[model samples]
Target: MQAVTFQAPGEVRVEERPEPDLLARDDAIVNVDATGVCGSDLHIYHGRVAIEPGFTLGHEFVGTVVAAGDGVTQVTEGDRVLGCYCSACGNCFFCRRGDFHQCDDGRVFGHGKTLGSLQGAQAERVLVPHANLTLRRVPEEMSDDAALFAGDVMGTGWHAVDQAGVRAGEAVAVLGLGPVGLCAVQAAKAAGAATIVGIDSVEDRLEAAEAFGARPVHLMEDEPRAAVKDATDGRGVDAGIDAVGHPDALELACRLTRKAGTVAAIGVYAERVQIHMGVVWIKALTLKSGQANVIGHVDRVLAMMAGGLLDPTPLVTHHMRLADAPEAYAVYDRREALKIVMTP
Candidate 1:
């Protein structure tokens, strides 16, 4: 099977790799239908997330179950499914507390050995562990493009808003208008936020955010803090989300939120970065940061997508054959596409 493999920084190669098979009673095997090239993939591509060379490199996937072990009861052979990016043991300490993202036995696909040694889904076939929790059937009406987001990007966006505790008639400001940022805007609206501000320098992204009912503020050309303040009537937003994994974005999110508001950092942060603790302490802000609890939120995210309350299909800007993954990565790296879906 041809799979996208990491070779070096800024490079991915489509090479023939062995197909995956079930390794446990809870495991299932899926024949790839469609997989996504996500912003997280860029971290590995740029050598920020160190993975072994030649490791299969993708996590967001929608496929048909080809085989399933006896313990896998949620899905059967031939079932159309979408998988969460990470797998978690349902009975673990963190899992029991509804923090599946921090499960002791958790494994993230395509993230190399440090994450779980699990190979990725960017191939003809991939293995799925904890199938009952990791895989969900795709809704009959959901397209592959839309179904894929329920597992990862959209779920992360929903997590950001969920953790922030946004209430109806409240205001939100999302720092960075990338896919996750745009999705955050949609989630905020679904949660009944009266005002949503999207910050980014990219004109296209700003436009997309506006289409999603957010007030677009250019990161450089416009003062985000002032815009957020003015929109919130001088009190800062009820919730501020930093979708860009940078110190600057985090700081801006803190500044944009009200004194008692929450700041949700949903972006990928792999290392230590300095933050102004004085600001957080002085404002008594509630700060929530970490990877998204997609495992715990997939059902809700899928329900929203199936109900038409959340739609991410517009975010997909490119569709290519799996063999063209190299070029797809290049396009994504160059910021030419938003979401790239590849079929095997």
Candidate 2:
């Protein structure tokens, strides 16, 4: 077997690695058919997120079940599956409360030993813990490329909208047009948002957002605040989503949200950054930030995909073999692709 490994900052290598096997009764082994190079992978590539050198890297995956432990019954051998980026102990207090993302024993894949020594799916195979909770059977009609998002990116986008309490006829603004941001646009529309402002600097991304039924606003060329205000009749959006994990983007989300509105920071934030507390205080804004509970939402996300209410197939910009993962990472790092699906 071969897996993508992080040897150092700005360096990822594709190398032979041992195959994974079930390590627990709740575990399952998957023959990875397709995986994605996500923005979080870029964090490790840039050394912003520390991980052990040579650690397997990548989480987003869709595959076929090859083996399952005795306790794993939700999926069986030969079942097509997609897995959440992380796994939670079903018995945890948070898990019992439907807050699986905050489960006390949650472990993230491909994040080195600190996140659970679980090797990543950017390989010929991966070992999934708590298979019944982590893996979801892919619908027969869903493509590998599209089903891949049900476990991670699309789920995160759905979480963003869900956290913000987006309602029918409400105005929403999504900042950033990456895969997650773009999916947020689609989710907002599906949730019945009457006005969605998709903000990005790239023309192509903005165009894609428009195709998703959002009113695209260029970050620099067009005034996002002005456009949002006009769209909301002088008031800012009822919900603002910061899909870009940067201080500036977070601040902008604050500025674009109306008083007493909600700001959902769905982007990855791993470091300390400054934000205007006074602004939030004066406006009485509600702020929510954290990782997505993909395991909890995968069923609904897949249902939406299966029903044709949400389609992320358009976000797939490239498809490559797992052997070309190094090159794929480089392309993604350079922003040359939107969502690169790598097959093993």
> Candidate 2 residues 1-344, lDDT tens each?
99999999999999989888778998999999999999999998999888999899999999999999999989999999998999999998999999999988888989998887878889999999999999999999899999999999999999999999999999999999999999999999999999999999999999999999999999999999999999999999999999998889999999999999999999988789999999999999999999998888899999999999999999999999999988999999999899999998
What are the root-mean-square deviations of the candidates from the true structure over C-alphas? 0.7, 0.8
Candidate 2 stretches greater than 4 Å from native? none
Worst 10 residues of 2 by lDDT: 112-121
> What tens digits encode model 1's per-residue C-alpha lDDT throughout 1-344?
88999999998999999878788999999998999999999999999899999999999999999999999999999999999999999998899999999999999999999999989999999999999999999999899999999999999999999999999999999998889999999999999999999999999999999999999999999988889879988999999999999999999899889998999999988788999999999999999999999989999999999998899999999999999998999999999999999998
lDDT for model 2, on a 0 to 1 scale?
0.94
Candidate 2: pairs in clash: none
**Model 1 misses residue 227 by how many Å?**
0.8
TM-score of each prediction: 0.99, 0.99
